[model samples]
Target chain A: GESVGLHLPTLSVQEGDNSIINCAYSNSASDYFIWYKQESGKGPQFIIDIRSNMDKRQGQRVTVLLNKTVKHLSLQIAATQPGDSAVYFCAEKTAGGFKTIFGAGTRLFVKA
Target chain B: DVKVTQSSRYLVKRTGEKVFLECVQDMDHENMFWYRQDPGLGLRLIYFSYDVKMKEKGDIPEGYSVSREKKERFSLILESASTNQTSMYLCASSSDRGSGNEKLFFGSGTQLSVL
Candidate 1:
């Protein structure tokens, strides 16, 4: 379950269930995509990243899918846990430039 | 691996008092940035420096200034703190070596409260 906030979206999921968070990027020319996770009192940590040339990339327990056609990016988490509850955001960067554009981010809440 | 350290986790200052926030990175990254995060605004870049002595203003630079006198340190200065300026400040750094080096490492952030 997910609720839209005034500025950020909230996603609620049960423990042991799979979760998918979606983001619609603004730039079609962006070549790199990244997913970051920020906890309650910590800075954002790198979760996973996918290049434009590739369609999907998988980490230990997370997967990132990139769709250049629609400028959409998604992060899939398997077997959601309480530790996985955090704010997830999408970021994009062009190949020739260093500036990265970030999405508004979605807050994931895990219900045990 | 890439550690960006901020001097303070929480700060309280009086209005009209000059405040300085220090950030240090050990990665020797060429690009360093300062951003402010709010409830609705997300992360807004305040200033960025691509070199030791060079800097560029980001989206919200009013009432804020930056100094990058050293390669590993970047400081954000508020000449006169205001109540409206109270927010979470984040410092980030990235490498300018070449393509595929655009991942930004961020500090834990400093929550500033101005009264």
Candidate 2:
């Protein structure tokens, strides 16, 4: 039973501070990793994704770091704002790439 | 940008009733998936269809069935739904562009309550 899990279930950050959410995956051969942000009453939205070949990839205000050696994935938000408060989860692309297994998720709360 | 749309935002049903959850994607994606989300449980795949009239059972496909009559539409059906089936249903689609890493676009999700 392969699984994806997060180091923390919840995180609180002061507005304007940087935030880091971590995830650990069991599948070593998993090549694709994705981060999703889900807000209240809304579906999960794509934040960023990184392939196994890349150590890090940057988006507008977020960076996805993939440490394939340790089977660890992280999402970092720069200058976190109140709007950044949401449930964030990590997913790994499985065999055939059609199915995805997701982590439990970390609830990010940015306090002003 | 891709758009995935679920038929309903919220639905209420009684025990033993049949349920149908509809999903449509405008991007003409080859892959469509149905997943159920629960608190602390994350997203569990129920079923997925890769092409028209073709389907595959996902991780937790016990009480569910799926239909892909058209390229853009995928449907999830529950026969004699139970109370335990109450959960938020999410529909997603991705391109089968041969890349191992698939970027999925999701619908708003249907919050179904089985009473």
The number of the candidate with the highest lDDT is 2
How would you encode candidate 1's per-residue C-alpha lDDT over B11-106 as one tens digit per residue? 999999999999999999999999898875557789999899999998789999999999999999999999999999999999967785478899
RMSD of each: 3.6, 0.9
Error of 2 at B32 (Å): 0.1
Those runs of model 2 whose alpha carbons end farther than 4 Å from true positions after fitting are: none
lDDT digits (tens) for residues A13-107 of candidate 1: 99999999998876667788888898998877889999999999999889999878877789999999999999887877778675666677789
Error of 1 at B1 (Å): 1.8
Task: Give the RMSD in angstroms, all C-alphas superposed, for model 2.
Answer: 0.9
Estimate TM-scores for all models.
0.93, 0.98
Q: Candidate 1: deviation at residue B112, Å? A: 0.6
Candidate 2 chain B lowest-lDDT run of ten:
B95-104
Model 1: per-residue Cα lDDT at residue A78: 98
B41, model 1: CA deviation in Å?
2.3
Candidate 2, residues B32-85: lDDT per residue as tens digits?
Answer: 999999999999999988899999999999999999999999999999889999
Q: Against the unseen true structure, what C-alpha lDDT does each candidate score?
A: 0.87, 0.93
